[model samples]
Target chain A: MFQSTGEIIDGVAKITLKGELDAAASGQFKDTIEKMAEQNPKKVVMFMEELDFMASSGLRVLIFAKQKMGAGVDIHLIGCQEPVLNSLEMSGFHHSVYLQETYSEV
Target chain B: MEALQLPATLDALGPIRDYVSEASKKAGLERKAAYNLKLAIDEIATNVILHGYEEAGLSGEIKISFEMNDEKIVLVLEDRGKPYDSRRHEDPSEADLELPLEERAIGGLGIFLALKGVDGFDYQSENGNNRNVFSMNRPN
Candidate 1:
C-alpha cells in the first residue's frame, strides 16, 4: 500500500510518503506532485522515512516533479531509508535532488 | 527451493516483494544483498506486468521460485506475457548517469539498475516463456 499527503506553506511544499512506492502508486505520487506544483512552491521537500520500497516508476515521478517544477525549484528528499537511497544512487538520481537526513531552509 | 505463482498485475508487486524478503531471510542474506535482490526482482517484475502484459493487451501469471545452496541464492521469475530480453535495451552508461535531470532519458533506467543491482543476472526465452534469473553470492 502507498499513501502520500502534501501541503504548501511559505513557498515551500512538503509531502510525506509512506508504504511502498511501486508502479501502482506512481500515479498517486504524480498527482500529489502536480497538485503541489500548481502552488508554485520555491522548494519541494519529500519526507520518505516511512517509504519502504521504491520502484523505477517512483523515480520517474521524481523526474516529473523536477521537470514540472522547473530548474529553479530545489527538491529535497529527507530521511530516506537505505533501500530507497540505493535506488536513487543506482539510477544516478541522487545527483538530481538534495538528499538530507533533516530539512532546514538555507 | 520454494515457488509461488501470482497474477501478472501491479497489485502483485507488494506480495512478490514480500516473498523475496522472506526468501532472503530464509537464505540468511546480508541486508544490502537482500535489498538488492528485492530491487532486482521488483524492477523486472514491474516490466513484466506493465510492458509484457498490459501494453501487449495480454494477461498471464508470473511464477517466482528460489533456490539456496552453499554458494548463492538464485531467484527465478517466469512469465508468459511476452518475450522480453532486458539485455536488448541499452543500459545507461556512466555518461548518461552524469547527465542533468532535464537531459536524462527515463527509458531503460529501471532495467539498467535492475541488472546492476544484482551479483548475477541472466535472461532466457524458452518454450514461449521469458525467464529472468537473479542471483547473489552468499557472504562467507
Candidate 2:
C-alpha cells in the first residue's frame, strides 16, 4: 500500500508515506503523485519514518514522480529507513533525489 | 523447505536471505553482492509460489544452489513450474509507464530488476526444466 498525506507547513508540501512500497503498491503511489502534481508545490517533502520497506517498483514510481513533476518541484526524502535508502542507492536514485535525516516540522 | 512440493512460501524472507547473506559474507563478497543474491533468490521464489502450481492443488520441485569463487558469487535457481524461462521477457520500457494505470504490468519489474542487477546472468531451457544462473562480483 502507498499513501501520501500532504499538509503545507511553512510553505513546503510535506507528504508522509506510511506503508510497504512494492509492486502491489505502485498504482496507488502513482495516483497519489498525480494528484499532488496538480498542487504545484515548490518543494515536496516525504516523511518515510513509518515506511518499512521499498521495492524496485516503488523506486521506479518515485523516478516517474520526479520526471512528471519537473525540476521546479524539489523532492526531499526525509527519515528514510535503511532498506528504502539501500534500494534507492543501488538503483542510482540517490543522485536523482534529495535525502535528509528529518523534517523538523517541514 | 523440501516438503512444500515447490519453492515453499514463508511468511517472511529473512532466513532464506540470511542464509545466502551469511554464505556470501563468509566468501568475502561485498555487501552489495550479498544483497543482489538475496533479491534474485526472492524473485525466483515469488515466481514459483505465484505461478508454479497447476490449479492451486498440484505442486512441483524447485531446486536452488549456490557457490562463490574469485570475487564472484554464483547461484543456480531451478523450478519445475511450466517450462518457461523467467528471464525471457523484456523489461517494460519507459513508454509503458506513460500508459493508463489499469493497463500497467504486474510482477514484471522484479524479474527485470533481477536480470539487470546481477552481473553474469544466463539461462537455458532443457527438457521440461527451467534454469537460471545469476552471478555478482565484489564492488570496487
Candidate 3:
C-alpha cells in the first residue's frame, strides 16, 4: 500500500510517501503532485523514508512531477532507501532530483 | 522451476517484485543481488506490460519462471505481446547521462537500468512469445 500526506511548511509543499511506490501507486503520487502544483509552492520536498520499493512507473511520475512543477520549482527526495536510490542513479535521474540523507539535512 | 502467470498490467508489477524478491532470497542471493534482481525484472516487466500491451492496444499475460543453478539464479519472463528484443535496443549513453534534466530524454532508461542491474540479459523469440532471460550470479 502507498500513502501520501501533504502539508505546507515554511512555504514549501512537503509530501510524505510511505509504503511501496510501484506502478499501481504512482497514480496517487501524481495526483498529489497535481494538488501541490496548484498551490504553486517554490519547493516540493518528498519524504521517502518509509518508501521501501519503487518501480520504473514510480520513477516516471517523479519525472512528470518535475515537468509539472516547472523549472523554477525544486523537488527534493529525502531518505530514499538504497534500492530506490539505485534505480534513480542507474537511470541518471539522481542528477535531476535533489537527494538528501534526511529532510532536515536538506 | 517455479512458474507464475500474471495478467499483463501495471498493477501486477508490485506482486511480481515481491515474488522475485522472496525467491531470490530463498536461492541464497545476497541483499544487493536480490534487490538488483527485483529491479531488473520490474523494469523489463513494466516494458512488457506498457509498450507491449497498453501502448499497442493489446492484452496478454506475462509468464515468469524462477530456476536456480549451482552458481546463478535464472529468471525468464515470457509474453505474447508485440515482439521487442532488449538486446537490440540502445542503452542510455554516458553523454545522455551528462545532459541536463530538461534536455535528456527519458526513453529507454528502464531497459538501460534493467540491463545494468543484472549479471546477464538475453532475449529471444520462441513460439510467438518474447522471452527475456535475466540471471544474477550468487555474490562471493
Task: Find the candidate with the highest DockQ and give its number.
Answer: 1
What's the true lDDT of residue A45 in model 3?
92
Q: lDDT per residue, candidate 2, B22-106, as tens digits?
A: 6677667676566666676666555654565443554666666677677776777676666556667776676664443333443
If the candidates were sorted by their DockQ against the true structure, best first, what order would they fall in? 1, 3, 2
Per residue, candidate 2 scores C-alpha lDDT tens digits across A8-103 of 655567778886564455567787777777776677788899986566667667767777777567788998977568666545456557888876
Q: Which consecutive 10 residues in model 2 chain A have the weakest lDDT in total?
A: A87-96
Real interface contacts reproduced by model 1, as a fraction: 0.54
True contacts kept of each: 0.54, 0.08, 0.37
What lDDT does each candidate get? Answer: 0.89, 0.64, 0.83
Clashes of each: 0, 0, 0
Better of 1 and 2 by DockQ: 1
TM-score, candidate number 3: 0.92
**DockQ, structure candidate 3:** 0.53
Clashes of 2: 0
Q: After superposition, how far is residue B49 of candidate 3 from its true place, in Å?
A: 1.2
What's the TM for model 2? 0.59
Candidate 3 lDDT, A29-80, residue by residue in tens: 8899899888888898999989987777777787778888787788899999
